[model samples]
Target: MTITIPTGDLVGVLSDVVNFAHPKPDGGVLNCVRLNWDGEYLHATATDRIRAGISTWHKDDEPDDDGQDDLFSNWGGADNPWSILMPLDDAKDVISNYKLGPKEYRVPLTIDLHQGVLKIERSRDTGHSRLVMQIQGVLEEFPDVREILANNDRVKPVTGQLYTAKFLADFAKVRARGPLQLAFAEGLTHITIGKRFVGAIAPLPEDRAAA
Candidate 1:
């Protein structure tokens, strides 16, 4: 299956969530970016057990089905959402490679998934490819982070928890040009950066936060 997305949108969503991925090699599925295509929106999420970041890019046009090349045939429906856990290294490679050459922000990026391998490519012309990278998708199941977020009430504070200022700074790295908005609940802190990016951070224990 092939999914086409705008270059800038893909890069921006990856950058917004990639930093929240687990930094250690032993983190397993936590060391990946979860890409979910839900019919109209492309959602990216990453978590390190302590913190999580999520970003969404919306595609305005409803894809038309033309038999073989229909992007919506295999996935991107209410019942069959497309999702994959891509390694953190592969996600970073895509972001870095997209920025290396002459900026063609208008080009569309295509992602191909076949047999267990995922291929990402950018094209300069009809037949000429500009940047390409491929890697196998992680086989482990990503945690149901949406359930975690959904359980919290964004407007009401359930409990107060403290967080390390150093770790909290991670949310600041999101590509937001405006002031960041932050809210807190019992155990999780909700962060909103600009419009499309949102983050969740678990608080440290009171004793640990003081230390």
Candidate 2:
């Protein structure tokens, strides 16, 4: 199982818009995840107040069993940056573990908060890809993400009930009139659906005067 992508690229894309909010009654953990950019791609998933998911990243090195002690301090690229934490699992239950570079795979990872980089020790086994990211030292201890996942209330039968309810209600409101046309442009995909404003919809061909 191998999936390799650019760390910097991944972080940059996800960072711009990764806002998953939890509004469950017993939803534990009031803290937000500040995904620490450590020159590695760490996939993560969480339900704002319902079901959950997980993802993995290609760190320079696989984190030790303890999963503490960041290697960023020793990495030293620049000053410092804000850290985003997401409740994610190691290659264990999250996404499939991936190869790193050509001619080598299956290496350990070390996270350095002080240096803002993930350390990897290359091995001569599988052909993996190498990715690099410019990260700064991540100050402040990252909140323990596992604590929320371990919560007993999380396993309740009514997980994501609120989300489900809202989605279903919204779905029913969709107009039977079919999909509405929005607009088109270069490097873009425009899709419109279920919006019911009399003026927002363009007139049908018969209603137009474009002789």
Clashes of each: 1, 38
lDDT digits (tens) for residues 1-211 of candidate 2: 1223332323322332122324332434422234443343443333333322222344343322223322322322322332434332321111223333322222322233333433322222222344222233233454343343433222222111112345223223322223544332221212233232111111223324333
Give the per-residue lDDT digits (tens) of candidate 1, residues 42-119: 889999888888888765532122222334323232423567789999899888877532344434677766666778
Worst 10 residues of 1 by lDDT: 61-70
lDDT of all the models against the reference? Answer: 0.73, 0.30
Q: How far is candidate 2 from the true structure (C-alpha RMSD, Å)?
A: 17.9
lDDT of 1: 0.73
**Could you list the CA RMSD of all candidates, in the order they appear?**
6.2, 17.9
